[model samples]
Target: MSIVVNLQSKAKPETTTKLISFIEEKLPAVRGFSGCMQVSICLNRDSGDLLFYEKWSSKEAHEKYLLNIQNNGVMAQLMSYLSDPPTVNYYESLDI
Candidate 1:
């Protein structure tokens, strides 16, 4: 099953643009990884929220990426823009 990691960021409005740009720049490196399926960034029209969708070939692939991120302290750098811990949801593709 494909693993989908949905991240919702509660960053302030003024910082949203730079926050998105930061992630966009970093995403290319992640998308180049072996198991990455797809990556998308979206803004919620209603709430002005930011969302990051990451699809991976398998749970192990995602887990490995997470582990590497922690070990390298890459995840720590993301803390500056967060209003709270990012809300992460794991899901399986039911149709696509």
Candidate 2:
């Protein structure tokens, strides 16, 4: 089964609009990345909470993707719109 990755961050209020535009522009490359099944962004308007919902072929694939972004400065660019460092959690489906 694919792994689900949830990445959450609080956007700086002033930059929230720009952040959404940035994510929209960047989503295509992410979706085309190897092992990425799907990815989407969700935002809470009132609280400025941003969520990155992703599915990948496996944990290793997602890790590889992270390393790619980190080394390429994409991660740094993305972080600049946020109020603080983001939190990430990976999930596996239950047999039920």
Candidate 3:
């Protein structure tokens, strides 16, 4: 089953511009990753918070991507742009 991930983070007001640029640079890599169905970035204009919505082929696929990111230090580099820790949640699509 496909999975959806929501990642939320707050950027320091002063770092918002840098944060957006950094994410934009990295998005293509994310979109090209194996098992990545789609990905999007959203900004809360008033709060300057960032929301990442991602769809993956499966939980295992997402976990593999996470491992790859950790191994390549991509996660650490991304976290450096945030003022606070990111909040991540996963959901399985409901067939209803």
Question: What lDDT tens digits, residue by residue, belong to model 1 across residues 28-59?
Answer: 87898779999888876456577889999987
Candidate 2 colliding pairs: none
Candidate No. with top TM-score: 2
Better of 2 and 3 by lDDT: 2
TM-score of each: 0.81, 0.94, 0.91
Order the candidates by TM-score, highest first. 2, 3, 1
User: In order, what lDDT does every prediction score?
Assistant: 0.79, 0.91, 0.88
Cα RMSD, each candidate: 2.2, 1.1, 1.2
- Which sequence of candidate numbers ranks them by lDDT, best first? 2, 3, 1
Residue 77 of model 2, lDDT score: 91
Tell me the lDDT of model 2 at 37: 97
Instruction: In angstroms, give how far residue 19 of model 3 lies from its true place.
Output: 1.1
What lDDT tens digits, residue by residue, belong to model 3 across residues 1-96?
899999899877887888888888888988999999999899886887889999999988888998999999989888887888989899998777
Give a tens-digit lDDT track for model 2, residues 1-96.
888999999999999889989888888989999999999889998999989999999999999999999999989999999997999999994557
Query: Which consecutive 10 residues in model 3 have the weakest lDDT in total?
Result: 11-20
